[model samples]
Target chain A: MDIDTLDLIDQYLRGNLSDTEKEAFEKRIAIEEDLQEEVLIHQQLLAIHEQEKISLTNTSYQQELVQMNEILNEEDNAKLSQKIRAIGKNQQPHTTVRFKRKKTVNWFYSAAASIVVLISLFFIFNTPKALPDYYQNYVNWEELPSFTVKGDPEELFEKGEVFFKNKEYKNAVATLSIIEPEDKWYPFALLYLGASYDQLNENEAAIATFQKLASLTTSEEYSKGYWYQLLLYLKTNQKEKALEMKTKILENPNHYKYKEATELDF
Target chain B: MENTERYIQALIQGEDQIIQEIYKKIYPKVLAFILYNKGNEDDALDVFHDALMYIIITQKEKRSVILSFEAYLFVICKNIWKKNLKNKVIQTDVLTLEEKETNLSAFILEQQCFEFYIAKFSLLSENCKDILSSYFNGLSYEEITLANAYATVNTVRQRVFKCRSKLIELIKNDKEFQKIIKWGA
Candidate 1:
């Protein structure tokens, strides 16, 4: 209860109490509830950490992490030393593929300067300045044949055909989507894209795409895909639509795609 | 991204960036824990090599879905050091352990628990670890005595008893053990 007793108890818990003091403390602590509770809580709190001394995870990895840091620090220090050595040495310029943005302020200042000069020129010589070709050629590509369809679509479409044959729907879709619209194989790309979508279980998207191909009625590719279009209808349980496609295909007896159309059975 | 999941996916996809990121982030805590446990840099090297190898092996052999690669690896490294300590001549006594109950992902727990005794034995005292390791290897005391020089069978008996008690004490005091047992190795 007294300060000396408290000090004795603290010393005892630390295993530093004198033998005589320990004896007196034991006699008092025998019936002292508060002192016992305090002792217990103190020991518990102390032991709690000791208990946690065991590993939560790989102890070595943590050690390695530390060692790794030391190694990295050493390496960084070495690099810094190298940089110091090169204090005034010659260096080669490095050009990385970074986005180099153009300054926009020149447009306003240059335009104001040009307008003033143009007013002077008009007063002096009665001539007009011609605008640059950037805006004039914005949409026009007739002179640029490279931008036009270069017939890669036919070759790519053949690859898509291979994918379709293997039933790789997504690959076929990807292979077909890159085709240029003006390529001879463009019609086939659209048709196969529709079939690929259908295989991927994208019914509505496939149907809408298929309808676009069907609207280009002049293409033989559209005629060939009529069966799949009908098959799509049947798959979606659109019986009326499937039958209508089947009837149209059957009615045109001389049509090159009629055989494949009838064979699908709608 | 969950570091473990990110780590594995990155490794599988050959993404060096993720690998470097994870390697940098978690290496410290692991190093500190191991160094405090009487582990040297060599032990660290072995622990990391073995842990990474195990992760890759498990991933390839079975579709391992590790959510926390760091946690999983930490457990492995700790276990390996413990096992090595026990198997080697060094006799260490484990008395108590404390653990926090963090609900780590299944993949991490499973990876940690998979054949963890290697690490456990390493941390045990030289005598207890040898006895336990021998026992685990299916060797009887007779066989052990035949292999090694013990005065009598009673010595082995006392050793095993003391060792088991010590192991129990170590585990009981270990907080990591507390967290891990709930997940159950």
Candidate 2:
């Protein structure tokens, strides 16, 4: 297009043209296809330029979101640690009462009783061949390789993974929960989310998340989710359900967790 | 129309509560669609954010609403996700017939053209960039002159026009721009 026509397009865009000139320009645009094309491109370019500015403003918003996530995770971690310490403190009085009862018993009988209790406690704490023992033997928490994609969301994923790897279950849960459900990392996030909940002893939440993950037929993470659910049931002393999951794993021997599932005692 | 307008207004204002409500209401379907189509939650989130940004920009620039908010947002998200999954084989059932019925090609073209312009805009001189940026940001001629310390309002106007024209010239000369225009046609 010529300079005058370009100028006219710019003026029209800025609403700088007079009424008569605007009328004439509109008529020319209706008749002249090239002029119309030029006008459209100009408008699109202007719109894009404006969009660039709006996007610039979003940089700070993205930063704030990252900062907020970190702060929230820290707060949750602190609260969880405090609760765990309080629970430990509460258990101390029960142990003291048991110690006092042992002191008040007759000397000869207490000696005999102590010997039996020591053997029983040793067997109970050190050599249990039960579900909890199997869980302790089989549960190996490995760090998932950090899969970084190009975006702000990836930062959250990485942070959540770090918390998971560090065994900061509460922090991991807080960080991963902020990730949008539609994110590609969401299935992995859900997997870790359920694992974190399990570690924190939030059995119901863990089971719920694992169930949700298992329900997604399209997810590559589905089989892994089912396997985790099976382990979770075992962890929670649900032997019947764990056996059902064992059957599922045995049925699909080619599943990712098939080998591990085969070795599980229950 | 009223619902769309309210949504658009909520977006422009960056109302966190409404935005959260939007996510709660709409994101699950988008997430399911992405996951089924070989996309992950990450791709879905990125597509949704980009789509929302496009809507905000379009609404602000046009000062008008045409399509329903849900339809417009879904179409934008679908197009962006398709673009992201260009190399992957997509399922035909990803979008329903009703969604496919929306004439989203125009908006898609506009987005492409905008992206192209942004890429080319970075190549302009700093002075030209500032002038054009200020102009597009709706700065008054007098305000632009005051900000940039140009001699007169007329000078600012001329410089803004010159910078915009230069941008157009650069875009016209670009091979990618030619391809985009042809593809858009």
Candidate 3:
């Protein structure tokens, strides 16, 4: 209880006390129940302190994860770039980023579908679906689709349209591709998918997809058809084409979606 | 076995595969921990995520990890709950469980006792608290002295010793804490 005894106890903890002092403190703790009790408390606290470091997902950790995700994304992009260059092919990164974005949108749909599936499983059987909850929750990322775009091409287009209405585009794209010209929904799918590609920062794919959609026959073109393409061009800073699309929109002021298109700058 | 193999490796590598593994293998445990801690489904989820993130960070940082990943995860979650308590955050759960004669029960009790001791730490004078905290934070005597503006390293040393003794006194006299140990033991 005395300051000297307390100081000696502290030094003992620090292992900084001279040998004589340590011996004295040890003796006191042995003979004195009160001193022994104090030692136990200190030791307990020490143990707790040693094992009790803070966790991330604490705000500090979240900040770090954002930084980490950015780094990982950059690494993935680099890997993708290297592989693309190695392919004895002609492709642009704009296209790659577009492809990545489409993948991202597909994942978004997969997540939505997984939720629907989970809800159905819960309701139907009051149990988890075949997918385990943990992995099921992580189905935030979808893989390439399993459904083929086969059947009567026109019927497939009809099915694709239904899917588009349901917002299942990966399946819709597969379905629609078999139909005439693929143009019935090609413009819409192309533009949306191109945007998806853009969202993933795969610029080249987005531009090419958008351009191909834009070049369809005038009969298929919306009065404001170019707006969608223009948006893609604008996104990639393809000023010439974006401007051209804008001019096309300007010339056909009466086209459907044109008023809305004019109100916006691509 | 293939599923387990795929998931655990993915988890070990910090991939999303562990999310499935966790849902299947460990989510029940996490949910149980949450439910015991007076938490709901949401807390169970948040704690589970935080624990996994902590494990990945620790592993990535090359910390020596020898415990079963399951045990390590629960401990991290428990620690996070304690910090939540200290920060006066919304804490609806205390993870109370019936005393039982099992190693897991003992470990839980041990954690409860440690938490009790840690709570008692706040009762000390701020200076005493600071000195003790500095020591535990791995501050050197010189760093402690410089930070606290003590006259010398000897002064810092003397202060830390006194702080430890005071902490002991606080811990011994806390009856509630003793009861936790008794029930836990």
Best by TM-score: 2
Residues B1-185 of candidate 2 have per-residue lDDT tens digits of 87787778887676656666666556645654564456655556556665765565456545643567777677668767765565245444455422321212234344645556776888899999888787777687799999989999888877777777788788888776654554332
What is the clash tally of candidate 3? 18
What is candidate 3's lDDT per residue for A59-161, written digit by digit as tens?
4434434544443235543343233223212211111101110111223234334432111111223443332232222222122122223342223333434
Which one wins by DockQ: 1 or 2?
Answer: 2
Give candidate 1 regions above 4 Å deviation: A1-155, A256-266, B1-185
Model 2, runs deviating above 4 Å: A1-7, A14-18, A30-37, A50-266, B1-95, B101-110, B175-185
Residue by residue across A52-85, what tens digits does model 1's lDDT show?
A: 2223234543443344334323553334323322
Assess each model's interface with DockQ, reporting 2 decimals per model: 0.03, 0.05, 0.06
How is the predicted docking of candidate 2 categorized under the CAPRI scheme?
A: incorrect
Query: Which segments of candidate 3 are over 4 A away from where they belong?
Result: A10-25, A52-266, B1-101, B124-127, B137-140, B152-169, B179-185
- lDDT for A248 in candidate 1 is 72
lDDT of 1 by residue, B54-172 (tens): 45434643464445677777876676565555545553442221110011122234344333333454568787777865643546668777777888876775675566556545545
Can you give the lDDT of residue B163 in candidate 3?
Answer: 76
lDDT digits (tens) for residues A101-190 of candidate 2: 012112323332332211111112344356656555555556333443334232555556666777767556655665566666677788
